[model samples]
Target: MPPINVIRNALVAGSAERRPAVLWALASLALSMLLSSLGTSIANVGLPTLAQAFSASFQEVQWVVLAYLLAITTLIVGVGRIGDIIGRRRLLLAGIVLFSVASLLCGVASTLGQLIAARAAQGCGAAIMIALSMALVGEAVPQARTGSAMGLLGTMSAIGTALGPSLGGVLIAGFGWRAIFLVNVPLGLLTFLLARRHLPVDRRGPQTERAGFDTLGMLLLALTLAAYALAMTMARSHFGPLNIALLLAAAIGAGLFVRVEVRATAPLIDLAIFRDPGLRAGLAMSALVATVIMTTLVVGPFYLARALGLDAPFVGLAMSAGPLAAALSGVPAGRSVDRFGAPRMTIVGLIGVAAGSCMLSVLPTRLGISGYLAPMIVITASYALFQTANNSAVMTATRPAQRGVNSGMLGLARNLGLITGASVLGAVFALAAATPDIATAPPEAIARGMRITFAVAALLAAIALTIAVASRAVATRPVRDEFSVGK
Candidate 1:
């Protein structure tokens, strides 16, 4: 329980000026989002260094990335519901504190095991922020401005991903890899202070005396996702009996999780949402887009640096073009979604994404930096359009009571895409790397493999587009209230 003074302060603060709340909320939430995005890119720059430092295989060190994604993805639904059970602000505060502490620990970690553990903790903190920030912003802001505000939030997120590699590289060069984690400290402290001062404290109903948490379900879900991620990550090297066993175990656990959700008194995942066609389409598209996006993210860097022989930082810069375009395009896309129904935006965005993927698939291997940059711009713009429409579609279709659950599910879909993207693309790269005539194989052979992956991603995007089109058969209700932007 919070101290008396803290309760008193919240009451007083809640009644104070509204601008402070917006500022406080945005500051903390934006930086938190930034940190999460940064985490994804920061580790890539240090892959070589960590390999040398720990004398570990590349596949082993890759868990630094895989673990964080798995932890955050699996926990999103459970954590989102937990925030509803407790309070969004309280969870946000706790999450930020934990994230900062974890980051600090990550900076000082002495072993690969410790770093992986710290990253998982960091991911936990990240889930809290991602889960609550949308609802918090929706609660605080009016309808008219919500689109712009959420658009701005999306923009900042893209920028964070854009900056991560460059920032990580600079920090690693100047002060070792640890600085990437340490950089979050000051920003986190400021966010915490500001959020505590201004975020509204809305007590929904009387707190339950003995509310039960779905601990078993959460553990089962986590273990299932962990096993799946482990199996995928391991598929690149040796597909041994052990990995096959893990994959089978994961499938069984997933089945059990579904059963638990169906029967639980207050299930962690609200399975009823799956019954809604709009939500089903939105979530399906979300997952497909996620896979496409993640696949491109992993393959783009490798193609540029390894196949094209670009420098590390330059590869980061080349990669930033996609995110930069997405950042620039997000707000306009959001406004477009507000004025028009999501179908047009959805169709256009999906088409653009598929078209861009197709364009990337055929790019000549002999092309230079400009060749790389062109494809990125198309992909990013398409992403921006898809994300804006997808978010609006999910929130608009969901009832206020179920928004948190829907959002968490959307996050899960996206993360699942990321996991599959990493796995499938890793497999593609593995296949390429395994070619027998590698020493004499044409430089374009690697490029050809990348094209194959892009083609797969394009197909996924096209399927999502098809689903979005089919969703129109049932006819979605046009969203009237603009105030529920982040709902």
Candidate 2:
């Protein structure tokens, strides 16, 4: 009913000091992003310790990470849509509380099963937090500054990721593997308090009351994602009848979800968002960025440890380079996106990733640790540039009311890329190596696998580059400020 700038001013009028409100909101959301990102990578360093502690096989112990990934990927969309309906702040605070409790449960678990379940619960809370954090940050800042806000969040995530392996290693060595999970409790509580004190409360309106929540659509979508995750995780080794059944179930569930969403008054995921070419391109690039990042994360340790004969500590150090690079470059990349627009930035970022991947593919088998460093830094810094710009682009293309689901879509693209990267790249590595057990494989085999995997990753990045280039002419529509707090 009012001009967009008036609506924007009204939203920030809750606090006399708009600058302070923006800072606090950014800080709180950054913390949420950091914690969730930490959870994604921290447990990885402790996998062997966990396996030994539980007297379980590596495959069984992997459930600790797999469970978290599955839960987060499956539930992020539904929970994000729920955040729009109830309140982003309320959902985020609750997520922090739940994450803390789940962390406690994980710390005290006596059996591997209990720990897996706790990790799943932790992932559920993480899904809530991760899905809303970006949306909230977008809502808090003016549209013009959205890129910078997203950059801050992206920077925190890089820091968290960089810290995860190093921190997890210290915790495992000092206390135990359980200490890794236990550490989240205090951090979660702190985040909860800060979010409660700083985050803006959602003001209910006619839109909130009128939007129908699609419960059945949510269920079908969850089932689809869960089945897909399971199928992907098992595809490498368990391509049996059971895996086939899971794949079929996933297909069926996806079909049902599509059918339900088309008819629902308020779909769990609004398919209409894909109509915007910029949003679609951004989502695709987001998936490609995730794939590149996750593939590097998944494969780098093995290459460093096995091919170069680096120890665990050295491997951790080597892996930290990319995140460090990402952290350093994130803010500048965001600011650049704000000034120059996202398309050119995204294209440059993807080209950098492809170039880095190409370098990795041709790297010599017997090399110094320094050999890995340069390529990783390039890849990660490029990812930082691409991510911040793409995120800003996606947010700019949609209305304020759609932020929740659009954020969810972004998260979905990321998780799907993660799942696909880990599974598909790992499978490619294994197949290239001609052995299922890559850890124990010969140095030559490991090197070969790494080269092939990196080559494939480069190709994926190249494809994403093409998409980004093609979408350069598409204009970003202004975000509708229809749901401001005071309006």
Top lDDT prediction, candidate number: 2
TM-score attained by model 1? 0.87
TM match of model 2 to true structure: 0.90
Q: What lDDT is reached at residue 483 by model 1?
A: 38
lDDT for each candidate structure: 0.74, 0.83
Ten contiguous residues minimizing lDDT sum, candidate 1 = 1-10
> Model 1 residue 119 lDDT?
90
lDDT of 1 by residue, 268-315 (tens): 776886777888898899889888888777778667876787787687
Candidate 1 positional error at 319, Å: 1.7
Q: Residue by residue across 252-351, what tens digits does model 2's lDDT show?
A: 9999998998988888878876787888888888887788788897889888988899888788778888999998787778778877877778888889
Residue clash pairs of candidate 2? none
TM-score to true structure, per model: 0.87, 0.90
Q: Residue 83 of model 2: what lDDT?
A: 84
